[model samples]
Target chain A: MAAEPPYLELLESVDSFPHIDISKTPYIEDESSSFYQLLLPNDARCHGYIHPSVVHKLAWTASFQVSHSIPRTVQLLDDSDGKDTAAACSRAFYEVIEKAVDSKIYPFLKTMQWENYRIVGAKYPTVQLLRSAARLFGICSRGAHMTAYVRTNDGIKIWVGRRAAHLFTYPGKLDTTVAGGVRAEESPFECIVHEAAEEASIPADFVRANAKACGAITYVAKSSTAYGDDSSLMTPVILYNYDIELPEHIVPRPQDDEVEDFYLWDLEQVKQAMVNRAFKTNCAAVMMDFFIRHGIITDENEKDYLEILTRLHRKLPVPTSPSEA
Target chain B: MAAEPPYLELLESVDSFPHIDISKTPYIEDESSSFYQLLLPNDARCHGYIHPSVVHKLAWTASFQVSHSIPRTVQLLDDSDGKDTAAACSRAFYEVIEKAVDSKIYPFLKTMQWENYRIVGAKYPTVQLLRSAARLFGICSRGAHMTAYVRTNDGIKIWVGRRAAHLFTYPGKLDTTVAGGVRAEESPFECIVHEAAEEASIPADFVRANAKACGAITYVAKSSTAYGDDSSLMTPVILYNYDIELPEHIVPRPQDDEVEDFYLWDLEQVKQAMVNRAFKTNCAAVMMDFFIRHGIITDENEKDYLEILTRLHRKLPVPTSPSEA
Candidate 1:
């Protein structure tokens, strides 16, 4: 065996989130508890977990049924049509929580962005939740991360960004070229197009034409600072990774305050930065995956080649697909 | 929700092998029992499971110590050195079994080729076991599979092979263009190079330069037919997948009896073949992963996109890397 590779630790850092077995975990519905379930109207398929420190403040209205035995199972009591009606009712519930929740008590509320994220794997119908609340409520969040590079005379040079220091999470860390959470009803590709334009100042048409969806990386993540809370979250996320080859002439400028600057670094420099823990945890994982796909890191050189490949795409203990009828 | 995709069933079929609980399972060290453990000398990191139906026939030689309560834990009694000595002893033990055991009772012995596969994750050192005996002892077997494709005016077309009907496993089923089990001390790329020549008649230099190591696919596979036994075997495999774009002038001809014929089919035709269950279970999984990475399978078109990606790279419950210390 050779020396343990530095990049494997990067994967371990991002995936330190513990696995929760829903069958054994305590759930509270009617009473105030730490974990609550978000149930649907007609379907028994979808399941979500939210912290009681947040949801306990909400008044139990008539439109909700709290199941005592089912550990935080809260069913929407909408009498209208099943799918969309339940979605609308769930949306209203989150909106009220977003406005009424005290930021001092639930610090995650202070970081709320008005954007909406649709919970994945919700069959028959789905609900859109506030982006900031997605982590508080343990749901499989979806996002798109694109690696933009230019073919240089030396080799392929990647475009990387230094996140703004004032950001709420992972501040001052290195990040992928373009990455953002998937907005409501948006496809992964469309999300990349939107993020590419907004974050990297790249044109949407160029991204739509050149950005190729390589695959996705799924991991359960937890951090105290990421969600602005003392309670570490079960933040399971699915990031659809992409790669785009840019013409050498096109340079990326920081379009918004989210990014401070952009740099074109060669492979060795990028790998060193990863070893230095300069990149954000998930973004480092994305780059490590990209190198494997492009044949930079291989089974010959890396001792943990197979382990890293498998760990980068860990299966969610929670349901990640629509139920088959 | 939309109708369930047929390809998801293909993934599920290959991964139906049940998870074994090592702690709860009974072990036989002194007496006849079902499960046995192969313990390495001075190293507690690596562990292997073998069915007693096969190992019980071996003579209780003085060169081995079988722990009574440790569930058939057998330690090689070699004092010369730690790693290589243990490997030599293990090899000698299996050689004796190969010569003395009745083929009628242990049918897998008849299919034993002269090839040796090094057992992965053995810490202090490692051992090379007979390829045929790999699944009998549930170790992580490594292999390489390469998908060859051509870029035509019509679009990208993939080259697939149909296995020969007389083959022992997956006879007459579809397969990747080039694939073979990794021999001892052989890297995955070297395995692909060797397999490409022996299986597809491709030149070694061309394969060396053109093949790109995209990623890998892993699964715990079990089937009565694959291993020629009544008791289904726990066959965990890691296949380092590669892709190569061949010029249209180059054609893949069956260089050996392993393959019957090769065909160049477009994307839709390949997908239809997968939906129809034409490919071997693991080979179909490899192709599905290829499609996902090439952007042919999008999140919009495939609802199980994230689920499939994560499932294709399942983390083995068994240790997969060399010990950190």
Candidate 2:
């Protein structure tokens, strides 16, 4: 057999974070605790993992209305009359932390684009957090990705995107044809349809009619911005994957700065790019899963076929869907 | 929202077995050992698990050529000049054990149909074991299943089969359109193609042209025949799933007694059957996975969408593919 393909390495890179028992981590306002578990007001489940650096600041923020009702648990106290008090309190803390922390030390805090990411877990209602602070709090965020392809005389050709170099994270990396974070209060399908039009210039009507909700790709990876000294965060992501077959006449062009250009590459070209590690880590996984489902990657050709399939769909410790309030 | 649909119960049924620390199980022909780990000749991997009742008999069968090279492990000794000595020795011991033990006490032994199941594990060459004895020794078995559906005027319709009532196992339970054990040396695709012709009477030429190989479903369940006495066993299975869109002109008829009849059911009818527990345990999982991939089961409708998706594709402890040898 040829040397093990680079695909497994890409998967491991995303799943590279060490397994830490959040249950054993400090919950109360214990300064000695290296990590803090995010908890809801009354829910018993751990909502997220917060590093000590952010936890210290969160404990000092009086307006945030945080609580420690249970021993060794950090629950966000929301007694206000607002409908989405959890979101209000969380946004308040993130804003305070952004001003208090050094941008050079915590670069992610400086890239607040106002995109809201909804975090949900267990019995706790959904809370909207700033997208840039999702990784800092070790929250499980949702995204929608779509792979558009066309059947041509040559064979199946996939639409690939190159991220703009000016982007904040994974800049200049290859990405799926259309991908974006599922903003607060947006369903995965609606998010994908919106992203297709904004990122790929595909008409929303065309996407709605053609995009097939294939399933999802999930993984828990250490945030790329982890400074590895005093601060680190776990970033669990669930990307609802979609596949849309476009006609030869419908060409995809970049409509935003998120993507530099689009290329229709054949299977061999896609595999080469994957092996070369040009695609973003999770995007490679989404494409790899697509290949398996489409039969391009089979048990015969890929030795790690089963491993790849299982790894791509790791069960996140946090809840994936929003709680109906 | 809707009483947490019965789908999760079906998944829990197949994955209902408790996890045991197989590493702690005794080996090296220890009479006091409750369970014995099966080791290969000169291979370090734990190939299978043996209940004490079967292990006691295996240790006494000298001609079967078993050894205890390592502490707390039963290694099958294969030093003969003949090819595939492991299979030959295993067959010899199983035959003796069958006659020594009463058939009424172990009913699985009485129904051997001479079907060979190829068991593969880490670093070990594949060994063929009798299909009836696979569960007796806690071996990982391979099977192939295909769901045949057609686009109808009303909606999409699937071809489902009812197992023959006279069958010894899971009799009268509903099953996928085509499913069968993948025998030694047969690829999953080859096995599915063969089963399509033999079980469903679908033309081989048509199946070959239309069937799409769409990954696999894996699970580890306690054998139903496990008397829950001293002779229980774990059964790990991997079923390669295929999707074939048959034209309305073509209809499937039962070609053998394995299936009594085939019915074309709509989406709601299939969901009702799934909820009613009319389908076989693992077959329900296959259909559930199908619905998710086809977009019938979605995050909006199903609260446990991510959990179900991850549970359907479990990572088996044993190797899924055969070693080159």
Native contacts recovered, each model: 0.87, 0.51
Chain B TM-score, candidates in order: 0.87, 0.86
Which tens-of-lDDT digit does each residue in B69-181 have in candidate 1?
A: 64457665664454467466566557545654454555766766667777777663346767777776667788899999999999899999999999877899999999999
lDDT value, residue A233 of candidate 2: 66
Tens-digit lDDT string for candidate 2 (A104-138): 45555566466878775445345667777677677
Top candidate on lDDT is: 1
lDDT of 2 at B127: 60
In model 1, the Cα lDDT at residue B65 comes to 74
Q: Model 2 compared with the native: what TM-score?
A: 0.87
Pairs clashing in candidate 2?
A27-A72, B27-B72, B27-B73, B28-B73
**Residue-level lDDT tens digits of model 2 in B1-325:** 1233377779989865553344443442455545556665656666676665666554345444444443344566664556767665556546655564553456556665667777755453446667766776677888888999999899899999999999877899999999988887788889988899999999999998889888887877866644323544667788888999998888999998899999999887887888788898889998988888888788767877887887787656555544422
Ten-residue stretch with the least lDDT total in model 2 chain B: B19-28
